[model samples]
Target chain A: MLTSNRRLVVYGIAGALAIGSGAAFAQGAVAAQYRWLTFAVFAAIICVTMYVTYLAAKRVKSASDFYTAGGGVSGLQNGWAIAGDYLSAASFLGIAGLISQYGYDGFMYSVGWLVAYITVLLVIAEPCRNIGKYTLPDILAYRNNPKAMRIVGAISVVTVSTFYLTAQMVGGGVLVKTLIGIDYEISVMAVGVLMLAYVLFGGMVATTWVQIIKAVLLVIASLVLVMLVWTPYGFSLPAFLADVVGDTKVQAKVAGLLGDAAKNMTPQELGQRFLEPGLYFKAPIDQISLGMALVFGTAGLPHILMRFFTVPTAQQARKSVVWAMAIIGGFYVLTLFLGFGAAKEVGPGVIASIDAGGNMAGPLLAQHLGGGPDSFLGNFMLAFVSAVAFATIVAVVAGLVLASASAIAHDLYVGVYHGGDIVPPQQQVRAARIATVIVGAVSISIGIAAKGQNVAHLVALAFAVAASANFPCVLLTMYWRRCNTGGIVLGMVVGTVAAVGLTLVSPNLTYPKAVRAASQKVLDGEAAKRSAIEAALASGDAAAIEKATVDQKALDKAVTKAKDDMKKVEGKEVSIMGLEEPLFKLKNPGIISIPLGFLAVLLGALLFRDKRSEELWPEVYARQNTGILASKATSH
Target chain B: MATAPKIDWNAVIADPRFQALHRRKQGFLTGLMIFSVVFYFLLPIGAAYFQDLFKTKVWGVVNFGILFALLQFVVAWGVAIYYSRVANRDFDRMAREIAADYEKGG
Candidate 1:
């Protein structure tokens, strides 16, 4: 009875928040481009990973092996897996796509994932390793009231997992659809089946190896990209950047993001402005919201926290973070080169020609740098990158499924449902396999349903949930003795509700403006004239198509009329569920939800005042502090 | 009957070696975090308010924001490397010494 309320309230709020953004993206703008070579390369990568799964499955025996790879993974190896799981397609493609299109705003996206490791290093990882054997719930249950702790922990884990998994799947499906001519539904399900097979059979052991392989391939890809981008300019970054300064073409290309204000500026001034601040984060609140979410959210992600348990000891867990930071930091530096190089070399016009959404910025940049479209270099590089991207998505999804499945089997089924420690390891492992399939199926459905949504935005919402629901509970448990079971439970619920609630009402998730149809523009003879030009292009001089221009007065009048209507509706206070205008002004909910998460923890601890939480504190504290529990270490 | 581990958290906290380890980890982390937070905020805050300052070129063709953003990666790597060194030489050694002391009932 207590458990059901936790799951219902948390998932309910999160589900509602996701629906609005998912619906807005349903009208995806990117056209699918089928490349058979990309398909063959993708198939080869799949074959290798499936073979790895077979090897891992042969060794799997117990639940301990299922969740943590028997705690035998070395520091650097676990570090590689962490990097693999952490750097999803969002980092590889989304960052490049965004950077090539948006410039400085795009590079800021990668900084968070890099800086997030600091939080993981100094704060969460060691204590997590010391206390939790398998799931986030294990740490939460270390103190008072295992039932209460398990309920909220399970809820928080599943909520984070589902949102994060849906994001990876969405990116996987859409990018695959765009690169190869596969349908989005088929691509999503293909990813789902691969993820399910890995977790259900290979479990954590195979998942770790797959992550390590993907991470290595991705880093190598990033390095090669940096070299390719620089090779055109005699490998001199300064020469390339300076060369971009006076180019009227590159300046005009970035003009849309710079706004109409830049139209009067000289080309040099325009170039300088692109490198200056405020391309993306123009507001102080938006910047802070982004920072808070990235830093706190990374600390709270269930898969990342679970990675610490794979290492033998707390010390190695700490070392793994440093390794992740090194890889991530270097990767972001290379991304800077890619983003600026794409701006100077590929240009926005070329980027738009490939994909309107800029999702192809990285892959297309690789192809362009290799050679023009018709060349073997271009075609081959594109296929190679597509394979790496598909691998990136698979590794991320496998991790998500594993994390979510553990939350279900280890936390919910064994810890809560079957009663803790009474259920055998054998039974729990089987339950986890079942849970993986169910989670995989649901994620695939959401991915297909949410196809065309912006990858970075979907991911930011997931971070907001993690920052709000998970960070506070985990931090308080590590530091504060006063933190009660009720405190964490209340914190998780409040944080989830607040983050989801604020996100739903945020301006970022607003329904895109309705297009005033072209049928209405026929009154000015514009549509008729355009059709005439199109007909001429088919039978007459192709250059004659250049004579087509819409009647400016009629178009301007339509634009003004639409703007006035939106202007009037902008500040109007509507009901909570109304979609016409957002209730919250900020694009991100982190600035509000993070503090609320902490507030709920404080309030609940003070209000509920469970003596049991206080009593068990020293024992949990002792273990966490010195790494000793019940006459021995917990695990490696 | 299974025997529980004999533990004394108060003694551990009081141990000089433990205190040194704690002090080192906490101090380095606190300084690093503050430096990171302040340094990170400077990019955005400068970008938001002092746009003109970041627009000025310090080296070659790169503007101030570019240098500042690039420096973020360097500082992150430097801090991590520094932490790792301190952990291997000082903190880990202290941890082992404290554990040995507790085991010997010293």
Candidate 2:
């Protein structure tokens, strides 16, 4: 099916990945025990999900089924799916980890995510369901030049989804390595292959079910953790909170972790300070920027938006948003308890020692709550939570892949390249499958290559892009009367460029790094000297070998020092633009970029006047509001 | 799918019921959106500016800041529930009638 050149490219990529991961595999370390328990849980999960996939595969007959599950998903089911898709490993692991380390400051980071859903329920959800079909671009292409709108929309979807997918993939791999004993490369490969199976075979139907299952599991697990955490305090909320802030043991734990940073503060001061804000977000503006991104960006996330299309009516869509808000809001509330519980029970020092970013806080707490690491209950709980986290990654990534696949296949390949013609449904489904494979392969390769790198910022970057690029166009096209094809295109281009451009120059990227050229020169020269000494020491001449051995020890010490010096200077020596710091101090660009997006949409519409767009405005508005002439749910 | 009835766009927009629906819905949505945005931003702003006030303990380990933050969840849910009820009661009925009238006219 593939051309020789394409096959060669695929083979070349595969070969590079093999060789790259092979090198890292040699040094791979596994942190937790009871590998068999993790494997057993993982096997059970895969079997159940794959069986659901098999059932879904039989029902997927046309492009509509592949894209929107034939528009048959119930409101409650779709809401669960949305919750599952939106709450990735980041929400479950990352937020808990942050809260466990930073206390109240970490809890502040989570509040915005739940409130953002109100924006979706009020402004975006129903209109999107009424106007869209199969993909997000359908809303734009409804009243604009189909080719231009679909193409641009497809690009935006791919860009946001790719950034998000990479983060999930890398997180999944690292967590598997820590939770189970699997090598990172093998875990990444396994996750990628499993995701491909779901998207390529079962399409949206299976993705939705996987998400529902994962959401239920994640929620139940969090609830259990929360209950177990508070039970020690006699299930009293006030008592728990009091203990969190007043317990001498907790204060000692915090003081020990703070070490030199504790200053002259006593246990009481540290305990009281732990319940205040300003620990994680030292800069007020940074918190505002992050808030802006979470609030606005969630409404624009392509995968989350795509879920709206799976249900039939705008009413159902509206109901789903309410359901999602409750479920997601409850889950986020649970994180507060989980984080503080982990802080008190597991201790920040132990948490940081495991993963440094506190990613292991939730699972580690589970182990502690089940009776310490040496107990069987502890091992079982850890394995169960870790497996749930793994499932969370798979469900989220599958949703992303499906969204981008629809963007590529339904929006660009069929909508644009086919000149907006009605392609055969089977052909469209086939195209979507092909797109799934391409998207999966590309994200997997990037994920493997980005191993062990700090990817927490990628999630924020995705949200910023979605907020800046996609949200503006969707809002303007639906609501603005004079919004033309030119306006939509220009808005997308300008918004994307502005958001990405600002990020490039923001502190997110412009932080210091050691001069690569100088560092590499010293390292390469030292490596050569060490090799020379190693060669001489390998010979049988005792005196020469003894002298070479001394030289080898000196070379080794020099290399170690050189590496340490490089690490120390990484964020101290220089920045990309040869400046001490970036001009843009805000880490997340949403506060500025979101407004710039709206301005671009306004300017583009005013500048590029199109009579046809204005003429069609009434019909588009009526359909958006009243849902007349909207696509019906496809009957099986 | 049945062929869609041809309708006058300007006339529809000019219709009293349609205008009322649009006016009421927009007024509600715009006001709520503004209030929510401002209310949402108050978190970071209040936390930044009112540090001493926010740090005042209310109960055992509870402080003004944590209570305020937690109240956001309640506020968000309140807004959603209230809006959905209003939309279902008034907006949906008005929109439906407008659609039925248009169908008859066309």
Candidate 3:
């Protein structure tokens, strides 16, 4: 009777939330077509995912089984799952949008991401699997002070996970709103509930299989879509280029888009920008930076790394990574076509009209080429794509929650509470599930708060955090024996602060008004006046234009003052010399903050090296041997 | 002088079955790794560069390359499983052989 009462309460709450969500959906002016499919797909995916989780739970008999899938998952399966996890909506949608806007510079993301895996395979992969029990803190604490490592690891996990979770939630909302006529908040809540259910019930086993299925589907769908695109265009690279070059509007847009990239360009460079077909080959440095963030960030991601641990043996790890690389690489190549095809077929005007956020290009393409939104194929594709996007968010969120749960359960709670004595497997698993619900709730709150923010941009902030705080400590601990807990902790703190602090203050985070105001004061006074004049001209109010010119000198002076203030705040030279200077100086500093994190770790290690044991050799040797052996076995 | 604690030499190397199993596992994993490398790096580059010869548009060639890459991934997975089974068998055999040799004390 008590159990039934509890069940009733649970169902009642769920029913209320669903009802509320439906009301919100109706009020938000969502298209009915988008709503039905999204709801159906969301329900279907959640059900299937939960069933998979149930199977995993049934199989769980030990801590090892729950935490690492008993290290028995095949390498190939783990690899696909890893790729699935790594290739988020941000990568698929965001990169495509970036390419549509930026051109060749966009491919830099592909290079950065692919090459970072090389570093992972060589340096981090085997060692991480061998030494770390669950979370990164496990490995760090193994050699140093547990108390400090736990605190730092928790901070790192929470910080990265928070940003990642928020971005994914935003993505989920966008997916719902875009595909299934629903309110953004309701979509976010729906995704949150679905993810919470999966993590709480199924755990890592469900997470892995879900990721694998999604990865396969994403790859296959992309391939088919790319073929559809080429069939119309005749598949000739040079011919495609010629057609693109022939479009004067495209050339003008490309030139406009390149902005600063054109400043120091040779004729050939300028010509190439106008001539390029897909913007896969030529773009500006900022675009390059964005790409680097995507690519290099992949290796440093905690969620992706955790997937490797689920597979048994170093050999399996190796196999999984190889498979992941193949799938991910192939998927990226297909995205190029998708991006270009969208540009060709849907046209940029439609994209600009749908959402200025630029993340809707791929779905919009599916709608146009497959058939309009009302067509069977089109609606199905829309639902499928949106579902995939939602699935991507759920899969990533599950990984984040799991990582946080592990950090709490394995590192903090177990390490502190049990003093390394093995906790009962069932108890530990229960603790992890509880942790998942807690994390899920917190993430949902954050997602609701960060309404309407660009999901991709938010994800980049997570990457910046990961690159700054976690990457440094992980790398130093693995390679440098001199690194002590104090150094690792301090370095992580410093890195996290620098990256997060800078990101918060940067133009990306600040409101557009603040950015414009800040920029005006930093540049020259005359330039500021010129901008005001231009604004007046654009508005085409002759009376306002004449009046604006009378105070133009004053406005110019204010602009200069603003520019100077911005320069002072930014700690870089601001010149009226060109618009590019302020933007470049402003942008580079944020990204540059990431490397400072690496330096902090190095400094910390150097300073604290003597305090640690002289014979750190034994532990280091053990870890290295295990890593190498695992790698060799997996690589075989 | 006291001999170094009698090393378990017989226990270390006596199991031919274990070696065979280990070798099979190694072979399988190695094959998979090779496939992954080719699929990810070599094939994409080849297709991109030689799209004209493939008689497909560049994009089509790239798509084909991806298909091949997916295939390679499957192959790599198969090899990994084969390797794990063989390697575990070999390790077991080797351990048994070593124990037997130690017991015989030849």
Best by TM-score: 2
Given the true complex, what DockQ would model 1 score? 0.51
lDDT of 2 by residue, A93-176 (tens): 989999888888778888889888888988899899888888888888888878888989999999999999999999888887
Q: Go through the candidates in order and give each one's DockQ.
A: 0.51, 0.58, 0.06
Residue-by-residue lDDT tens digits, candidate 3, A199-313: 6655677778778877877787787778887765687655554454444334434544565666786543443453232344332344444444543455567777777677756
Question: Among all windows of ten consecutive residues in candidate 2 chain A, which has the lowest summed lDDT?
Answer: A23-32
Fnat of candidates, each listed: 0.40, 0.55, 0.00
Listed in order, each prediction's TM-score against the native is: 0.86, 0.88, 0.72
Best lDDT among the predictions, by candidate number: 2
The candidate, 2 or 3, that scores higher on lDDT is: 2
Off by over 4 Å in 2: A1-33, A247-264, A513-580, A631-636, B1-9, B103-105
Q: Give the C-alpha miss distance for residue A551 in model 3, angstroms.
A: 31
